[model samples]
Target chain A: MEQTSILETRHLTREFKGFVAVDDVNLKIRRGTIHALIGPNGAGKSTFFNLLTSFLKPTRGEIFYNGQNITNMPPAKVAHLGMIRSFQISAVFPHLSVLENVRVALQQRLGTSFHFWRSTRSLDKLNDEAMHLLEEVGLEHFSRVLTVELPYGRKRALEIATTLAMNPQLMLLDEPTQGMGHEDVARVTELIRKVSENRTILMVEHNLSVVSNLSDTITVLQRGTILAEGDYATVSANPAVLEAYMGSSAHD
Target chain B: MSINRILFWFTLAVLALTAPFMVYPVFLMKALCFALFAAAFNLLLGYAGLLSFGHAAFLGTAAYLTGYTVKDWGLTPELGILLGTVAAGALGFVFGALAIRRQGIYFAMITLALSQMIFFLAVQMPFTGGEDGLQAVPRGYLFGFIDLNDNLSMYYFVLTIFVLGVGLIYRTVHSPFGQVLTAIKENEPRAISLGYQVDRYKLLAFVLSAALAGLAGATKTLVLQLASLSDVHWHMSGEVVLMTLLGGMGTQAGPLVGAVLVVGLQNYLADLGSWVTIITGGIFVTCVLLFRRGIVGELRALWKRSF
Candidate 1:
C-alpha cells in the first residue's frame, strides 16, 4: 500500500496440477529501484516473474501496479501499460536488421502497425530514435547487421535496447546475463545499471556478484517462498539464507 | 526497390506485353490467374508464416459468386469480382479467427478441413450447377464501356489486375505492417511481449491474402467462361500450395514462375494424361530434396554468391 511501491503482489499463488510453483507470497517493488529476486534452481523465480507479467495466471491472489489491479490483464496490454520484459534467452528478430529490430518496438507507438498499404519508408522517421537506443546499448556500429549475426553478448544488449524503446516504467528481466563470458557479464551489468536510472527493474539474476553490485533490495526465495529479504550484507549474513544457499548440514 | 530489381520487373512486363502474339492468350490468362492465387497464398505462408491448406475455398467461392452475378444477375465484370472478393474476405476472417489459435501443421489442417466443407457445399449448391458447373460466364464489358469480348482486350484486362494484385503484395511485404508480420513469424512470443496484438496482425494478413486469392478466382471465372466444382476442390488448394513452395515460398517471383511452369506442363503434356500429376509430384520432391527454397530462391542465392 506504500505510495512509493510501483508494483505489489498479495498472496500470489500458482500450482501446476498438484505442484505449487509460486506459493502464497506478498512482495513489493519500490519505484526507481533495482530489485533482484534470487533463489536456487527450481525455486519458482521464473514462475513468479511470469505471474507478475500475467503470462501465467495465478491460482490465488492479486497484482497491483501503480495502485490499479492488474491481476488478469493480458500480457500485451500490461506491456502497453509500460511494464516491458526481456526473456531468459536472448530474444531478437533474427532475420531483421538490428536497426529494424528496434524500429519494430518503436513502430507500436505510431498507431499504424495495421497500415499494410503504407510504405515502410515512413518508418524512417523513427530511424534517429532507434539509432539513439542502439547507441545507448553500445550497438550503433552493428545497427545494419542482421540480428542473428550479432555475438551472444550483443544480442542480449539489443534485447535491452528493444525493451527500452517502449520507455517502460517497470522492466522485468529474466536472466539478462544467463550465458555469457566475464567480459560480457560485466558489460551487460554496466548497461543494466545505466538503463535502470529513473526506472524500476525486477531481475532474476543467478550471479551473486552481479546481484550484490546492482540490486537496491534483494529477496531470497526457497521452495517457492521468500526465505529472507534485506540488503546484500544483511541477507547474505542471515543464517537461514546461508543454509538455503550452502545447505543445512554444511556446519554439522 | 533496387535499380536492378526495377529493371527485372520492367523486363518481365515487356515480355508479358508481347507474349500473346506468339502464344495463346487464353492459356496465358490461365497462368496469370494461378500466379495471382499462388502469390496470395505466399503472403500468408512466406511472410506471415501461416500455411493454410484451404485457400481454394476463397478462390472457389469467389469464382462461383462472380459467375452467378455476371451470368444470371447480369452484373458488370468489375462489380462481380468486387462482390466475390469481399465475400471471400469475410470467409477468410472467419477461418483466420478460428485457425490462428493453432499453429504449424494444425493450422494447415484446420484450413484444409474448412476448404473441404466448402467443396462439398459447392457440389450440392444449386447455383453452382453441380457437376456440370455454371458455364457460359460472359466476360462482359469492362466498366460498361471497353469490350472484353475480344480475347486480346480480355487478356489486357486480366494483365492489369494481375499487376495490381502483385504490386499490392509487394507493397504489403515491404510495408510497416509487413514488418510486424515478419516479426510475428520469426518469434511470436517475442512479438507479443513487445506489445503487439499478434493474433490481430495474423488475422488481418490472412484476410488480405484471402481477398487477393478470391480476386484471382473471380477473374479466372470470367476468363474461362465457367465456374466449376474443381475450382473449389481440395485439389485446387493443394495446387496453390505446390506452386508457392516450388516457386520459392517467400520470394517475390517464385509463385509466378512456379504457376507458369506447372500450368505450361499441364497444358503441353495434356496427351500424357494422369502422368502430368506424376511428373509434377516428381519435380516437387526433387525441388524439396535439392534446393528447398524453390527455383527462384536457389537462383538468387547463386547470383549472390557469384557476384
Candidate 2:
C-alpha cells in the first residue's frame, strides 16, 4: 500500500447472476495523478467504475477511501467524500440551461439545495463561479442555451464542466470522449489535462491515444482482471498487454 | 419578463375576476379548485417526473378532514383549511415514504393501489358519512369576521386561496429547490453522483404537491359543502392527470388552462351525460398525438418565454 494511494479497492468483484463482470481485482489510485482504466469491450471497465462510485455494490469485496471503509456506502455518500463519476453518455439536465446545469452542481456546495422557499435569484452570486467553470471548458458562449441543444462534442464539454462544479478531490470520468470528432477529442483531452492539475482522476477510456496521452498510469484490464499496470511506455510494450489488444487471451 | 408574459398573466387575472360576473360564480369556483388540484399534480409529474395515479387520495382525504373540522368540530374556515392541508402533508409523507421507493409505472401503480385503499376507507368510515357525505358543511366565517355564508364573499374567498396556491407553486418552480428536482428528473444517477440525495428531493416534491392538492380539496368543501366518494374516487385522480396533460404538464399555466377547459366543457355539456368523459378522452388523445407538450407548453415553445 503506497502512502499516496487515496482510493483502494481490495478484492473488488461484481457478478451479474453468476456471470462475473468484475473479478477479484485490487485497484489503488494514487493521489494527484490521471489514472486510466483501459480494457477491451465488455472487460468490465464500466462495472469497476460503478462499483468504485457505489452505483453498483460489489458482490464480494471491500472499498476504502483515505483509510476509511466505504464498501457499502451509497453513491451520494461516496460523492460527499469528494469522488464524482461522469457518464459514458453525455449526461446533463436537458431542460435546464447550460449555466443552470453548472449552477445546480455549484449550489450543492453551498448546502442550499433544499431551500425550496428561497428564490433561485438569491443564488445569483453563484452565477459568476458557474460561468467561470463554463469558460474553462470553452462553453461560456453557450451558457444561456438549453443543454439538450448543445452539439455532441459540446455536450461532453458541458458534462465535464458540471462535474467540475462539485470541487471534487477525485474525479471519475467514464469515457469522457466516447463520441466526438477528432477536433473534439483533442479539445476535451486538453480540457481534461487542465482540470487534472489539482485532483485525482480515474477515467475509463476506450481511445488508445486518449489513454496514452492523458493517463499518468494505465491499468489494462482483460476479462475482468488487470493484465498490466504501469506507465504507457511500460504497459504498451508488455507482451501480455499486446496479446490482449491483439485479440488473443492474455491468460493463455 | 416580456410584454407577452405580463399580458398573459394580466389577461388571466382580468378574465378570472370578471368571469364570475358573466358566468355562474359557483362554476368559476369549481374550476379554480380543480385548477389548483391539477397544478399540484403537475408539480410532481411535470417537474419531478413523478406520476402518482392516486393524487385523489390527498384531495379527497383533505376534503373529508376539512369537512369534519368545520362541520363537526366547529372550527373556523381558516383553521379547517390549515388542518386539512397539514393532514394532507402528513399523509403525503406516509404515502411518499412507501411509494418513492419504486420508479416509473411501478410508482404510479403503488400510488394507485394506496389511493384505492383510501377510497375504500372513505366509503366505509362512519365519520366520512359514506355515500350520504358530510352534507351542508358550513363555509363558516373567514377569521370569524368575514362572513363567508354569502355567495359573493365565498367566491372571492375561494378565488384568493386559488391565487395564493398558484403563486406559491410558481415561486417553488422558480426556486433552487425546483432546479434540483428538475436535475433529479433528468438523471437520477447523475444527480446522486453530484452528492444530492435524490430520494429526499423526490419526497419533498411529493409532500409539497400533496399539501397543495389538499389545500384545493379543503377549499372545495367550503364551496360545495359536501365531502363525498366522488372526490376520492380513482376517476377523479385520472381526471386531474387528464387536465395536466391537456394543459401542459411542465408549464406554469398548463394546469389552469386544462382545468378551466375541462371544467367549462363539463359545465356547458352537463345535459349530455356520458359524452363528457368521451370528450375528455378524445381531447387527451388529440393532445398526446399533436401537442405532446400540452397547450401551454406548445404556446411557450412558440412565444419563447418561461411559462
Candidate 3:
C-alpha cells in the first residue's frame, strides 16, 4: 500500500488489421518490483511489449511514467526518461569490444552522444566504472572480446550490462533467457536479481522456473486480455490460469 | 600509436610531400582531390551503413559553386570553396532528412532519386554552363597573397587540403559521435532502446560527408579549372562507390588506397580509351570477387588493424 506505481497503462488497445493484439488492457507496475508478463505464443505478449515501449503505437491508450503521459513519446525519448527495453534476443554491437558496448551506453548518458570532435578515448574516464558494471554482470573477463564472438548466454549477459549502464529507473527485458542452457538461465536470473535491487523490472518470460523464482508480481495475459494478476502462488493455483496454460501447452 | 603505425604514417606523409616532384603534378593533384572525395563518401557508407548512390551530387555541386563564384562573382578561391562546401552541407542536411526515414534498400533508392534531380538541375542551370560547365576558373591567391598559379604551389595547396580533409575524417571516426554512429550502423533497434536519436546521428554524418565531399570538389575545380556536367552524372556517383568499395567499405585508409588505384588505372590506361573502362570494370570484378574487403581492408586484416 505504501508503494507507488511508476508505470501505468490506461485502457491500452492495439489493433492489427482486424485482429486486436491488445484489447483494452490496463496495468499498474509498482515502483520497485520485479514483474513478469507470461503468455503463450500468439497471445499478443510481444505486441503488448512493443506497445509499452512505443515500438508499436497502440490504436487507443495512454501510458504514464510516474505522472507524465508517454503514449505519444518516441522509443528513444521513452528510454531517455529512464525506461529502457532489451530485445527478445541478445542485442549488442558485434564489432565493438564488450567494454566499448557498456561505455557507449554510459557515454550517451553523459550527454556526449552528439560530440563528433571529442576523442572516444576521452571516455577512458569511464573505463573503471564500466568495468565495474561488467564485473557485476560476471562479464569482466570477457571485456576485450568482440560481442559477436560471445556465447549466447554471455551475449544476453552483455545486453543486461549495457542496459544497466543506461541508469534506468525502470527496465523492460523481453525473454531474457529465451534460448539458454539451464546453467546460463540460472546465471542470468541471478544477474537480473542483482540489477532489480533498486530498479523496477518488467520482463516477458516463458520460462516458468525463472518466472516463479524472480517475479514479485505476475501478469498473465490470454489472447490480448489479462487472465490473471497476483503473486506466483495465487496465480499458479488459479483454475482459469491452469486451464489456459493447458490449452496452449497441448497445442504447443 | 604503435611503432609500425607511426612508421607507416611517416612514410605516407613523406610520400605525400615528395610524390609531386617525381610524378606529373597535375595527375598527383587529381588523385589527391579524389582521395578526399572517396574518404568523404566512405564516412557515410562505411560508418553509417547508408549506401548513398548519388554522392556525386555533393562533389559536383561544390565544384560548380566554386567555379561559378570564381569565374562570375570574382570571389577569392578560398571564399569560393567555402561557399561550395556550405552549399553541399545544406544539401546533405536536406537529403539525409528525407532519406533517413527509410531503411536499407529504400534509403539507397531515395538518395539516388533525389541526387538525380540535382543532376537534372546541374544540366539545365545557366550558372553551371549546361553541358559546357563553368570553365577556366581562376585559382586565385591564397588569402590574396601567395600566388597559386604556380603548379608547385598549387600542388602543395591541394596536398595540404587533402591532408586536412583526411585528418577531419580520422578525428570524426575516432570521436564520440562516431562511436554512436557505428552503434546505429550495427544495430538501429538496440540504439533506439538505448536512448540514442539514431536519425539525428545519421543526418549529422550525412552533412559531414557532404561538406567534406564539397571541400574535395572545390579543390578539384581549383586544380583543373573546370566544373563539367560529367562530374554530376550518375556515372560519377557509381564511380565513387566503386572507389570506396575497392578500397574497403569501412576502414579508415581504404578509400585513399582505392582512389589512388582507380586514378592510376585511369592514367595508365588512358591511351587505350574505351579499354580503360573495360579494364576498370575487370579490376572491380576482381576486387569484389577476390578481395571483397578491399586492398587496404585485406592488408589491415593481415596487419590486425585498420590503417
Candidate 4:
C-alpha cells in the first residue's frame, strides 16, 4: 500500500518585523517514515517547527494533518488531534516522579477530568499505560525517581516516553540528540528509531551522521528557504546543501 | 517502605493537632486559615511560576459572600461557604484567563491592577458596609447540629477545614496535572514544544489556587464572625506572599510553617498597634535579603547535604 502523507504544509511563510523567517516553504511528510529537517543555525528551522506546532502563527500558510486544515490551531487542540512535538531541551516536569510525568500526559489523552474528590491512583489502567510507555523508553527502573534527579540523557528519554503516553499519530522531535555524549547519542538514536516504527517521525537535526543514518528523506534549509530535499545521498551531493554546510564547516 | 518519610509526616500531623491546646485557639485558627491561603498562593507562584498580586481579591470576595449569605440570606454555614468558594472560582476563571495573557512582572502587575479594582468596589459598595465592614457575623451551626458559637467548636471546625484544604493541595501537587503545571513553570517554551497546552495548565493552577483561597477566607469569616476590609486590602495579598516565601517557595510544608510563624508574631505583638506592620515589613526584608531560601527550604538543603 502506498503510504499517505501524515503532515503537509503549503507555501508556509512566517515573518517577524517584515523579515521573512520562513518564506514560501512547502513540506510533505509520509506516514511511518523518519523525515529529517536539516539546516544551518539561522535557516529558520526552529521557526518552521514553531509554526507547524502552532507555537508561532505563520504570516501566510496552510498546514494539514490527517486531511484537516490545522493552520494556527492552539497547541493543545493540535495535540488532541494526534500530532505532538518534543522539545530539543528536556521538557519533563522536574519535580514530579518519572511515572507521574508520563501519567499526566496519559491523563490528558485519556480525557480524565480533574476532580478534587476522586483519587487518581484508583485509575489502574492509566498507571499501567504510563508504566508501559516508560518501559518502552527503557526508563521503567527510574519510574519512581523524580525527573529532576534523572541524568541528562535519561531525562531526554523520559521526555520521549511522556510524548508516547499521549499516543500521538505524528511526533515532532527537535534535535533529540543535540547535546549528548557518543554513547547517549547512540542510545537516543536507537530509541527514536524504535518510536518511529509506530508513528510518523519528523525531526530537526544538525548531526549529519545521525541524520544520514536515520532519515528516510532529508530537507535542507538555508536562508529561510529550502536548499534541497531528497534522500540523504541525493541531498548530500546537491550543490546548494554542500555550499550551505561547507561555508559553516570552517568555523567548527 | 520509607520509614523516615512516614515518621516525619506523622510527627508533623501530631504537632498540628496539638497546636490549638498550646497556643490561643483564636490565634491557631487564624494561622490555619492563613496557611491555607499561603498554600493556595504557592500553587500559582511555586508550582506554576505565575505570580499573582491579586490573591486578596479571591480571599476578600469569599469572605464577604460567606458573611452575607450566612447573615442576611440565612443560609446554612456549609452552603454559604460553598457559595463563597463558587464565587471565587468564577472570579478566578475570568481573571486567570486575562492575567495569563502576560508573563513575568507583567502578570504580577495585571493581577495587582485587577485586585485594586476589587478593593475600590468593596469600599464604595453599600453591601460591604463601607469601612465598618460586615461585622457580628454569626458562626451559626455546623451541619445544623454542632454549635459553632463555642470557641472550642469553632477551633476544631477551622482545623478540620485547614487539614482538608492542605490535603487537597498535597494530592494536587502529586497528581499528573500538577506535574504538567510545574513543567510549564520551569520552561514554558519547552513545555509547549512537548505538545502540552502550557497556558491551559497555568489557568487551571490559578483557578485551583483561587478556589482554595476562597475556602480559607470563608472559613476565616465564620471563625472570626466578621468579614472586614482588612481581608480585601492589598496588604493581605502581600502578607500571604511573605508567609509563603518565609516558609519556602516550592516545599510542601513550607507555607504552613511560615503562616504559623507570621501569625504567632502578630498575636504576640497585637498590643503594639501599627508597629506590627513595621515589624512584619522588617521580617519580609530580612527574609528576602538574608534568608531567601526560607526556613523550610534551608532545612531541606541541609538535610539533603547531610544525606
Return the interface RMSD of the candidates, in order shown, one decimal each.
Answer: 0.6, 0.8, 0.8, 2.9
Model no. 1, DockQ: 0.85
TM-score of 2: 0.96
Residues B108-143, candidate 4, lDDT per residue (tens digit)?
999999999989999999998889999998989889
* Chain A TM-score, each candidate: 0.97, 0.95, 0.96, 0.95
- Candidate 3 structure quality by residue, lDDT tens digits, A1-252: 324999998999999899998998999999899999997788889999999899999999888898899999999999989999999878999999999999989997568878888888888999999999999999999999988999999999999999998889999999999888989999999999999988999999999999999999999999999999999999999999998888565321
lDDT, model 4, position A1: 26
Model 4 CA deviation exceeding 4 Å by range: A1-3, A250-252, B1-21, B187-196
lDDT string, candidate 1, B1-307, tens digits: 5999999989988998998898999999999999999999999999999999999999999999999999999999999999999999999999999999999999999999999999999998788999999999999999999899899999999999999999999999999999999999998878988999899999999999999999999999999999999999988999998999898999999999999999999999999999999999999899989998899999999999999
- Minimum summed lDDT over a 10-residue window in model 4 chain B is located at B189-198
Question: How much is B131 displaced in model 3, in angstroms?
Answer: 1.2
Output the lDDT of residue B22, model 2.
Answer: 91
* Global lDDT scores for all candidate models: 0.94, 0.92, 0.91, 0.86
Clashes by residue pair, model 4? none
**Top lDDT model:** 1
Q: What is the lDDT of candidate 3?
A: 0.91
Per-residue CA lDDT of candidate 1, range A79-193, in tens?
9999998889898999999999999999988988999999999899999999999999999999999999999999999999999999999999999888899999999999999
Clashing pairs in 3: none
Best by TM-score: 1
Question: How would you encode candidate 3's per-residue C-alpha lDDT over B1-307 as one tens digit per residue?
Answer: 6999999989988987898789999999999999999999999999999899878999999999999988899899889999999999999999999998998889988989998999999988777889788889999998998798999999998988888898989989888898999899999999999998789999999999999999999999999999998788888889999999999989988999899899999998899998999999999999999998999888878788644
How far residue A52's Cα lies from its native spot in candidate 3, in Å, is 0.6
* Regions of model 3 farther than 4 Å from truth: A1-3, A247-252, B305-307
RMSD of each: 2.2, 2.5, 2.1, 2.7
